[model samples]
Target: MADEMFRAPVNRSMRTLDRNSFRKVIPLHAARVPENKNISKVRSELERSKDALHQDRLGSVFPDPDRDRAKSGTKCVLLRPGRRKEATETGDNPHDGAEVTSPPLYSSVLDALLEQNIIDLVPYSLYLDYSYWTYHDIISAILPEDELGEVPSGFSQVGHVAHLNLRDEYLKYKHLVGEVLIDKNPGVRTVINKIDDVGEENAFRTFRYEVLAGPDDLNVEISEEGCTFKFDYSKVYWNSRLNTEHRRLVSTFKEGEAICDVMAGIGPFAIPAGRKNIFVWANDLNPDSYTSLQDAIKRNKVTSYVQPFNEDGRSFIQDSAASLLTTTQT
Candidate 1:
């Protein structure tokens, strides 16, 4: 009934109503309705009842149309009365596993309630919950097989920003998908669409991005395994996904080890290594990355072990490695 009324890809539409599905979807108040109540009676009782989610069709209400199911004591979903066209489209039974080619998508029961709500309908956003249903989960049920390419499995995040590289076909729904992500993931402060690649040889490897949702700030503070890094997410590259690798690599180096980071971007590996009392000669071609590395060194209190340099990787290795290596070894 929830899927029929709200339009979701819930169960596969059971040939026979499963007990677990019954318990999950069946509105408790509707099943308890006494006598031969109609939609009017069901609505009235549902209004007073606590589990009154939204509008009801008639699954849980009084005498089920078949009457045979009600006699058999089978709990069912609330559904509407059948008109000729509707009956033919849905078949004799709403439980017949008939599919709607295009159904409305909702993330949660509360979201549906907000749409079909009787009282207190203003803050619909507050009611939306994306835990069980993601934008992909909802859109897949509504779009045709050919359009399934539109939904992405997941996205990348740096700081509070969600970066999505959508296919050309999915461009139309970009804003919609972005909004869904913002609503679903409360931690995300912004959703950015990747408009272009990191083309220029700028130190930060900066790329073009268009803000799809939330505020415009790209600077973010990221908390990884046990490190905090702050940077302009757009101005520099920081992949939160590689945090484990940073820790894993840091673990391999023993105390008093001399480390040379030729392409250290914002001290992810270098600063963490320095925290373990290892000496680090870190260099980045990007001025922004060098500045962030300086800030992170102070923030992590590893200034004594980390030496930050703003120079090309080749120059840092050829001109500086011999002196730093000799000093650290001694």
Candidate 2:
């Protein structure tokens, strides 16, 4: 059985994210203490204890100003979920209807603090909403139990667009997964899933894709190596993951050297090299890529050093070499 506290209500029918359906109330043990100079020491001890709650967004210590002890300036230091045996013995079971229990803690530090009257263990209800869980957490819980471990959490971001290449098994839940991705990732306004493998549809490396969530806008702008590039994501190929390779290749070109990019895609190599005062003859067979390359050269203020060409890679290689040789001889 899934851990009830962290589990999202599974609804395979869910197309959009239903935030209200993810609300959960978890009962836990908290160390209540008076607000004084020694409070920091008490917190430090609790944090070091094996029983302390450790979650990403949820803090271990919280100030409940509206509680009865708030008038005397007291705070609650939360502990991890108690074992079924501990909860049942005290008749304060947090997992009321759940079968599985978290590992029981035998914290010596907590025992010593309790014996000294430094802290008291009290029941606290932790209310968790949609924002508490991360993209992985939410996706893992919503997907089928068998597919839980292989949740589609990875995606490439191009400006406001998130590109995903989902497996065939997860295609049915593509829209649902895309919706959750947008909810968790800020500034991501569009999500797309590649319907075909790269180069399978065309030699240009552009693939057919479906808009899983948000608008169908594919025009995006991204900055790399101090240069900005703008392109239509669906028409031309661009991979943010290749930024390192682009930089490594561009760094090798000398200022006065002539570089020929036979298959330049949106001027990743040519534009950055041109920025360094290298003369580049950039060519692409894809008309869209050629157009974007020209735009990028102008956008990055490298028009004088970077020249764009629309031709086959083989033809551009021979022609550009001959042109460069003629220019050098003159």
My TM-score estimates for the predictions, one after another, are 0.62, 0.83
- Across 222-286, the per-residue lDDT of candidate 2 in tens digits comes to 99999898889999998899999999988888888987889998999998899899988889999
Clashing pairs in 1: 30-60, 57-79, 57-80, 58-79, 59-77, 59-78, 59-79, 203-286
RMSD of candidate 2 to true structure, Å = 6.0
- Candidate 1 lDDT over 141-246, as tens digits, reads 5445677664564789887889988887777766666766786687888999888776463536788889877899998998765668899887777777787899
RMSD of each: 13.7, 6.0
TM-score: which candidate is best?
A: 2
lDDT value for candidate 1?
0.64
- Residue 128 miss distance in model 1 (angstroms): 9.0
